[model samples]
Target: MDILQYEFIRNALIAAILVSVTCGIIGTYVVIKRIVFIGGGISHAAFGGIGLGYLLGINPIIATIPFSILAALGIGTIGKKSEFGEDTAIGIVWAVGMALGVIFIALSPGYAPDLFSYLFGSILAVTSFDLIIMLILNVIIILTVILFHKEFLAISFDEEFSEVVGVPTKTMYLLLLCLVALSVVVLIRAVGVILVIALLTIPAAISRRFTHNIKNLMLLSIFIAIVLTITGLYLSYIFDLPSGATIVLILGIGFLLSSLFEYSIST
Candidate 1:
């Protein structure tokens, strides 16, 4: 299939690049703070929007933004209050959200063909409109991360010390999560909810092995993510494989190679 022959394939390339930007920037924060599971929680919480979208007869993509944001807020806020471990709260919310989505989808009139698209990604179905939304969201996430880099750095490195310096750790934590929610919205269609946490963490995690500075890690992760995503897109196009699976496989291979390379150099 010639890439130029199909509009969907063309738009999918664009979406892949935009989502690379999203995961690249946000993934740095997630990896640096060791919030890998938190990232998973937010993506899982996105299912809440899926169910609500079905019950309300609305566009799932549109419904997902607010629903994910609310879930992120709840997770961040309640995680602070609950006596149990943070993951405990995140897990409870995560399981409940998935259950709600499952029940609602079962209750809806017809089977939603597009459900799998969001669940496991549909690179070929991406439209130019989706690309535009993705690009705009990427810009927003990037700019916000840059502007608040100091505060986020303070929070991630040492929350108690940051509080001593009056950094407003609580608000910063909430802000970081909202950014994660937005990242999930951008990524839901490109990489699927199940595997996006890999896209969000692996490249950054590998990159961190070599770089101590957050800035370098972010740059390296973005470079790795863009390369892996583009390579995956091309492979999926040529071999007729699932795009999301291809992307995850590519990232997994990249992670292994990066780890090996780092170890070899260190040894």
Candidate 2:
């Protein structure tokens, strides 16, 4: 309660809520489409963007957006057109992106004092500007989901049927990957590139265990994510733990508990 008086805390809270919304919407699609690996690849690839921003002396998050989008598109194209397995494509891109980021940072002149922060996250470091960017991205994601809900639903359930019915499956898939790229950028501030995929997928994965309906899944995932994030923030403050890791730990525990509950019910 006393922490709320601080500006940084308030910004972190707002960021958490915004992130929850973005993740809830985008994560639902990622989970239903079984593209969790793609999300992971995009997140790691975002590191390349961060490193590029550092080398160019610009904002890392801004650099991450375009870099991640390109990585997402590349991954999608390679997976679809090449004879290689999708996982293999993702693995290659994942390694190359991380490697590129390292090379870029190494070539940069000065010491990257904040590099670790981007890798592990520092929610307390979020600024008003970061919050504003996150808010706008959240709105964009929400509106996109609302506008393309039917198309997304059709493609997620049956891409062949969706293409047969003239839903432009390829275009929709690419658009969804773009949405994921945006979501990765949004999450980088809160959880860092390394842990973004966990934050993106865990809540939605937990929610799916309880409901099959998309709307219900999104709503539940948002609720769970908000609770876990806030709780993790509080715990990190009290116990002096890493905020991002704390949040992920809480979500993982929730998943285990949910799994146990389901097991009991089935038994």
Candidate 3:
């Protein structure tokens, strides 16, 4: 409770909740649709946007929004339309994005301070501005889900069938990837690009064990993410560990425990 007295701590808490909403919602789609690789591609590709932000003296997260969306669209387009496989498209975007980030950082004048935080994360250092950005993105994600609930659900569960039924499957898939891109941007400041996939997928995967229902899965995943994030945040503060890595470790442990428990019940 004493930590609540600090502004940074409060911001971290709010950001965690906001992020949990998006991760829970979007993460469900990622797990169900089996597009975790695409999510990873988008998250890592966001690093290029971060570098562009640094070079241009702009907010890195803001820059990452458009950059990540483009990455999502590109990967989706290539994998869907080109002769290349999805994995191949992911590899291409992944490598190019990281390469561009390196070049942009090199071109930027002066040292890039707090670059480690963007790469690995620093929840304790989250600013009010970051919280605001997270809030806005949360709204966008929630609204998108609400507006396209049926379309997204169809695509997640049966893209080919959805297309057969005239559901505009490609458009929906691309839009869902864009949502994932937005979720990646939301997560970068808290868990960073390196570990965003864990937050995105782990909670949703765990929730899937408990429920096959999409709405229930999202609700449960959000709850799990919030608890894990808060627990990890405090533990990191008490022990002086990297917050992002700490949170991801907790998620991994949660998944392992959930699996064991499920196995025990089945046996």
Model 2 clashing residue pairs (backbone): none
lDDT of 1 by residue, 1-267 (tens): 466677777788778778877887899999888888888988888987877898889878778888888878878887888587678878977887788888889998988778887888877888777777778888889989988999999999999999999998999999999999899989988888788798898878778887888888888888888899989988988899989989999999999998789889999
lDDT of 3: 0.92
Give candidate 2's whole-model lDDT. 0.90
Q: RMSD for all candidates, in order, please.
A: 1.6, 1.1, 0.8
Q: In angstroms, how far off is 222's CA in candidate 3?
A: 0.1
Q: Cα deviation of 112 in candidate 1 (Å)?
A: 0.7
Superposed by TM-score, candidate 1 places the C-alpha of residue 1 at a distance from the truth, in angstroms, of 10
Predicted candidate 2 versus true structure: per-residue lDDT over 1-267, tens digit per residue: 798999999999998998888888898999889999999998998899999989999989889988999988988888887589679879988889999999999999988998987998888899888888888888888888899999999999999999998998888888899999999999988889999988888899999999988999999999999999889988998999999899889889988999999999999
| Per-model TM-score on C-alpha atoms | 0.95, 0.97, 0.98
Off by over 4 Å in 2: none
Query: Can you write out model 3's per-residue Cα lDDT over 132-217, one digit (the tens) per residue?
Result: 89889889999999999999999888888999999999899899999999999999988999899999899999999999789999
Deviating ranges (above 4 Å) for candidate 1: none
Cα distance off (Å), candidate 2, residue 192: 1.0
Model 1, position 163: C-alpha lDDT score: 99
> How many residue-pair clashes does candidate 2 contain?
0
